[model samples]
Target: MNDTSRNVSFTDPWIYCLDHGYVTPMICQSTEVLCFLLGTPALVWCLWISLSGSISGGLKPTQIFPMNLCIVELLFCIEGLFQTIYYLFLPNNNMFLQVVYCLFFIAWVCRPLFQTCICVERYMAVVQPVAFIKYRLRRYRMGTSTLIWGLAIIYPCFTVSSLGYLTKTNDVLVSVYCLGGVVISFCCFFILRALKQPGPGEVEGGRGGEKKQRTTDPQKMRAFSIVLTNLVIILVSSILVAVGFFTMPNSGIDFYCNTFLMLLACNMLSVVVSPVLHLHREGRLHCRKGPVTN
Candidate 1:
């Protein structure tokens, strides 16, 4: 067995592990194929939407986040697609395992960090509307996007400091980091909910559809919903990381492979899911003439 992969990882060709769950070579190969299939359509859909989304005037500012997310996910899908190919045909290339892990680590970390950034921006829009509007979103979005990517790019440098070595501990730390981000997102979600409390002008219509107005603050409400969707995505992705961490292939050989396989496959999932969720939530609101929606 290779030094980079231990008992319950891809290198393990057997079935069942007490710790990581059931995952033989066959299971691993099948999971990779499944991810490739799901990621393909998601990649195409995200690309088309991102490209078209920019044309809508109201989507100019807001589209940046989803577009970026979709693009990143597309890269993720490509990575997984190549991985499936590698596993299926390049069985002799065992030396590249660490490289794959490095790429996956970077992509996994990026997913949550971007979502966190989205939440923070939405928070500003909701908590401080005047400042958000007056300050202009384009310049700040550019800066924020650069900063987040800068941080994400450099993150792998420290984690894989040895350059040639990859460790199981790296995965655990990434999961922990993701869990922390999830907690922060949860706090953001709560703050959004608090702001959504019924206040003056919040009530809409009566039983007979009287001329009662709707919404306490439409902008704030919209921001709230956007953040909520992001929060849900963050939570699910983070939970998967947590499970992978706990079920790491440290002990049992056969039982643990499933968790490891799931972890690897899901590294491609957030990219697909995040874009789809964003579109489902805000697709209709991106009017071409209105202020750049976010």
Candidate 2:
């Protein structure tokens, strides 16, 4: 009877949530496996092709954030892969697994920050071209990237083995995620507005400059697509975080499962979308006449 009751409780959503404070391992691991299968190959392909061009020539300002995002997705994929494998064998919680799970939080934290960086970069490029050109040094992006990476890695590392610290960290992250979504949305709006307005050169020189800007319309449209896509991704993620934070406490294990599954869904979306966007921009899937210039 005890064993039977234990088994019932193990599979029971509310009971399991109360006991474990996490989603059921079997369900979470199965979802992780699914995400791994779907995301890895595409991410690897995108990263390789992107690196090929950027490495042989030099890294363009536009390429930097996407590459960093690619790396973060790869790390997230690999971590999920590792967890799936680990759970396949053990199927039980342990201190080691908890530590490994911290990687998930680290990736989660990094994703929004990196995405915000990408949005801001795109915004400056399209909306404030003069300023973008002024501070377009690789070092500036490199410094920002370095700082983000350090903080993402360090914050989770120090919060190790402490659920309180982890919870606090997540609370802070949720706020940041909300802010990121707002920033991305505004960036998208401004980029769209920029698309309609004439550039300074166009205003000064009239129709000829207008014609030139029209010729670059395709490039502007592509930039807007990038920002819009990012806004959607960030918005979805923010909703998930808000849902998880609000519901995970009083909810059942199924809610936890769905919440995490949606988060991974966003990850998969990013993996697929980033590569598609990169390919489009490289003209690998399309033809282009001249490089994008404002």
Candidate 3:
């Protein structure tokens, strides 16, 4: 018995209190693989389109937000890739674990911020076009982008001070998600109002026994739809996070692993879905049938 016990201990030295020690890493690896598969092609295509458009001077100031979003998704994919590879190869390496966590943490926080920034840019364009003109300067957008990236980088520094608890980081995420929901909702209200109002050339002359008609701008309605979509996405993502946080305590190992896995799934989903929506907005995605048969 002593000989058998010694052999078992030698082969598997890592001690774990959980019933299933490998469950969490298995979940992480699976989800990370899915994220990489789904996110890479879409994100790469988006980056290419955005960069090509910029080179040709066809990119708008508003479009930069989606470009920023593409960058976030790329970071997210890279984090997942690193995590998957590290766990598969060096699961016992604490140093690599910390590096993966830091990358994951930064990408996790930045996703919502960039999503909100995109909605804000669209809000200004749809709600206050006149004011947006001045704010649309290249420097303004660049400055705001720089500020957001800076904050994301600096926010993780608090983890060291917090002894790795991440309490404050969680608080920041909740606050940002809530604020993003509010901003997107506000944009929805204004967009709906604009959609109902008639534009300058929408009213036709009624003097020649013609009926007066009111027409809405296709552009405004499109913006309204986009804002509504963003609101739904933000609300759903926020709810997922809230549920995870609220139910975290007194949970079983499986529950904890599942919760974190769900959160990662949610993050990857939003990353993939947001870019597809933006691609549609940018006129990159389309459906067309082949030529009609004789």
TM per candidate: 0.68, 0.75, 0.78
Q: Write the per-residue lDDT of candidate 1 for residues 1-294, one digit (tens) a residue.
A: 642355444343432232234435455556556656766675676667667756664467755765665656655665565666665566466546545555565566556666666665566665666876885567777777787667656665565545423445456456655665765566686667767776656777776977466666777677676666666666766776666655654544433454555565564455556555544554533432323456
* Tens digit of per-residue lDDT, candidate 3, span 40-80: 88789889977887889876777777788788889998898
Q: What local lDDT score does residue 260 receive in model 2, on the 0 to 100 scale?
A: 46
Q: Judging by lDDT against the true structure, name the best candidate.
A: 3
Provide the lDDT at 92 for model 1. Answer: 61
Model 2 Cα lDDT, one tens digit per residue, 71-175: 887777777777666555654656656656567777777777788888888789878999999999998998999998998888777776565664576576667
TM-score: which candidate is best?
A: 3
Residue-level error in angstroms, candidate 2, position 104? 0.6
- Which sections of candidate 3 miss by over 4 Å? 1-28, 203-212, 246-254, 280-294
Once fitted onto the true fold, the runs of candidate 1 whose alpha carbons sit more than 4 angstroms away are 1-31, 55-59, 94-99, 134-136, 151-164, 168-176, 203-229, 246-249, 263-271, 278-294
Score residue 268 of candidate 1 by CA lDDT.
Answer: 42
